[model samples]
Every structure is written in C-alpha cells, then in structure tokens.
Target: MTSPSDAPEGTEPGTEPGTEPGTEPGTVRPGGRTARVRAAVLEAAGDMLAEQGFHGLDLAEVARRAEVGKTTVYRRWGTVAGLVADLLTDMAEQSLPRAETGSLEGDLLANARLVRRTLSDPRQGPLFRAVIAAATGDARTAEALHRFYEVRVAEWAPCVREAVERGELPAGTDAAEVVRAVSAPLYYRLLTTDAPLDEDAARRAAAAAVAAARAGAFVRTP
Candidate 1:
C-alpha cells in the first residue's frame, strides 16, 4: 500500500496539492504546500507566456518546469484557458495596492507610474502582450482578461472616490471610469507605438485623467 506522502504529487491522501485539506478541489488556500505548488505553476506559466506567447503554453511543459506532476497541473487548471484564467487571478491578487497619496494628482500619478513600470518590465511586458493577443480570439480568455482589469480598476477606484470626497472632482463622478482613463493611454501607447514608456508619459497620462475628472468629463448622468 502507498503511504500518504507517496500518494502522488497532487494527491496526499488527506489534502489536494493545489487546494486545502477537506475543501473543494478548486478552492485555493492562502499558504502551505498548495500555495507553493500554485506559485511554482504560475511562475512557470508566466515565464512560458513571456518567452513564447500563449500558443507555446503547454500544461506538460509547465509541470515539468515547475517540477510538479503533469497530473497535478491538469487536475488544478484543466485547460490552457483555465490556467491562464488562474494566472490572471493570481496577478490581480499579487498586484500592488492603491497608493494613498494625500492629493488626487499624487494618487493618479502613482497609479500611472505603476502601470507604466509593469508594462515596461521585461517579463511582465511580454507576458501581458501574450495574454492580450490570446484574448483576441478566445472568448474565455477575453472574459478572464476583462475580469483582471476589473479587479485592478476596483483597487484604484477608491482613490477617485476619495478625491470626490475632498471636493477635487464633481459629485457623482464615475470612479471606475476615472481609473480607466488613467490606464487607457498607457496601454494604447504600449500596444500602438515603439516609443519608450518614460516617466513623462506616465505623468502625462495621470495629468490627462485628472484634467478630465476636474472638467467633469467622468461625471455620471442622472
């Protein structure tokens, strides 16, 4: 008979490798062996996505690189789309919190800089491009991508709300829209041009969002 430790890479008798003991198979725990396996898998997935784009992402390859069992990867993520969805979810969870700069400008600038830095990062930049490209033709991937942005926007929307409370912007300002405005140009520039994402570009993006907000452009209609 096999011992618990010898059950398998993903199966430990009492607990699943990627999920908590006695919990649902797909439920993610915060830490422990499960978390470590998840981290390893995600890291491998991101690396592959960065190096060869979505088409090159293979579950077996990811398991091999992560030193986990292929069975584990398949059981946890199921498909390439599933893996990418989990990857995006992990990215959103691990992303930086909203900046608490006293003024709205300061907060927007910080948000803009963070976005620029992420898009300009060697690994992150390529990973994002690959995911975005993958989403273009895949409905599931597109939904996951949209959820990823929604999570990010929700994280920063509070800053805009605070600005409104401070009377920096008009009442009924759509905080989500304001946050989106700050990131839109940076993403556009990243996808549309070969230009460097310099500090100036970040500042400009933040300034433009603030200007628009102050001018009541993001105000919601009754």
Candidate 2:
C-alpha cells in the first residue's frame, strides 16, 4: 500500500516538485508539509477501507490515525465519498505506465501480468474489493470507480492501437475493448471464486484477448 508520495521518481504523474491543479485540496503541491499530511490521511483512509470496508470509514478515525487535525480532514474532503474519490484518483495516478513490448501478444501479456499483480496483491486486493463493494450501493463511489477504470483502460489502449497499426489486429479495432477483455475474466475470477490468480491465468487472459482482437471481435462498428 505505497502512497503516491512514496512512489519512486517519474513513476507517477504530478510527483515532481510543483503545484498541480485538480489534485486533492491539501496536495496542490508536492514534497511539502501539506503534501505529507495529505499522504498520511489518504494512507489512513486506505487502511481503514482495506480492513473494515467503506461502511466502516470514519473521517475522525482517519484524522486520528493520520495524526492530523480532524477539521483539516473534514474541510479538505467534506465526506467519506469525497475522500474515497480522491483515494481512487491517487491510485490511478500512481499506476505503472503501459509496457511497450514489440508484439501484440507480448504487450498484452505485460498488461495481463500487471492486472494480475494488482488483483493478487494482499493490500491492493482487499482495498479494491472494499471499494468495489462500496460502489455497488454508492453512486459517487461508483462514478469514481468507473473513472479509475477509464484512466487505466486509456493508459493501455495504445498497445492495442499499435497492434492495429502493425497489422497484428484488425483495422478499426476498439483498443479500449481489447484492453478490457484482458482484464474482464481476471476480475470476474477475483470477485466470484476463491481461486488463486496464477501466472497461468494471466497468460490465458492475455492469449484470449489477443485471439479476440485478431479475430476482429473488438472491431468498432460504424
């Protein structure tokens, strides 16, 4: 559960030393007291969600755990939904960049592996499950979760686009759909079964996605 502030240099957007608009209120700038406090609060919020799910999240508890003023948390994030939205935003910003492997299969394999890693990670797995469960009944949380997936899908869509350009996939392939295809089954397995997400599962996911893309299953209809 590494916070965005703790991410290595150049790994995440807006990590450099400067102000960036649309960041969480207290995190307008990076590498300062404000940024540190923001990181602490978000970390505490994530921990609470991972441990007790979103229904258990409390702003006062988060502030106490973060050792920051309760007023600051309330003022900055207003509500639990707002805080969870910012947490999902931070997670999206902190995600790894897409792989640039030459072939479509290789690139898809890399993408599948990344998804597998995140869904299989101890901290991230529980955190995602909690967020997803919360989203089921919370409109704001659902919107935030959708946005998070949109960002991730956009980040990886270029791989499928490149495959199309290289004639590895059918022309007019829907890149986003192809990328989502690689993750759909993995997520289903994660939510439904108690099976372990092994490398074999990742490879199969990638292979299926590649087969679909090559067969024009992802082609966009006019």
Best by lDDT: 1
Note the residue pairs that clash in candidate 2.
none
Worst 10 residues of 2 by lDDT: 13-22
Q: Which stretches of candidate 1 lie over 4 Å from their true place?
A: 1-15, 18-27
Q: Could you tell me every candidate's TM-score relative to the true structure?
A: 0.90, 0.87
State the lDDT of candidate 1 residue by residue for 55-171, as single tens digits.
999999999999998877876777888889888989998999999989999999999999999999999999999999999988888988999999999999999999999999999
TM-score of 1: 0.90
lDDT of 2 at 169: 88
User: What lDDT does each candidate get?
Assistant: 0.89, 0.87
State the lDDT of candidate 2 residue by residue for 1-222, as single tens digits. Answer: 235676446545333334343555433435676678779999999999988999999999999999997876775677899889889988999999999989999999999999999999988998999999999999988999999999999999998898888889889999999999999999999999999999999999999999988999988999
